[model samples]
Target: MTDQQTVTYGIDGMTCDHCVMSVDEAFRELPGVTDVRVDLVAGGRSTATVTSTGPLDHDAVDAAIDEAGYTLVAR
Candidate 1:
């Protein structure tokens, strides 16, 4: 197996559990993703810690957030 990789993403518009669920589902659909944790704090912002089987693609992650109707903050 490949080494696990972690990618942090700034998520916008996640105001509730449903929003977190949406983001979680988005990451789960990725081919190499292992797990996703969504943490929402002040300013209506959230952080997603994505664990994957190998190095992840930043553009793909951003695209998934966009498809989920949420904004992706560049890191």
Candidate 2:
């Protein structure tokens, strides 16, 4: 099988399903990213689990969250 990598990130400011979809789309646009799962937490920090074909660039991840109008936090 091909190599794969998964990463989880803490996201702030996601308040609903729309926010979730925005973040999901952001990460999905990145190369190698196969899937993105987000657990909404409203006003609290939420988590995003990303599955990819290989290691994802940390900067790209951060940028994706930012593009989605959320903050990326380490958990």
| TM-scores of all candidate predictions against the true structure | 0.89, 0.93
lDDT of 2 by residue, 16-74 (tens): 99999999999999999998999999989999999999988889889878987999999
- Candidate 1 C-alpha error for residue 20, in Å: 0.4
Q: State each model's CA lDDT, in order.
A: 0.87, 0.91
Q: What is the lDDT of residue 49 in candidate 1?
A: 92
List, in order, the clash count of every candidate structure.
0, 0
RMSD of each: 1.3, 1.0
* Model 2 stretches with alpha carbons more than 4 Å out: none
TM-score of 2: 0.93
> Using alpha carbons, what is the TM-score of model 1?
0.89
State the local distance difference test value for candidate 2: 0.91
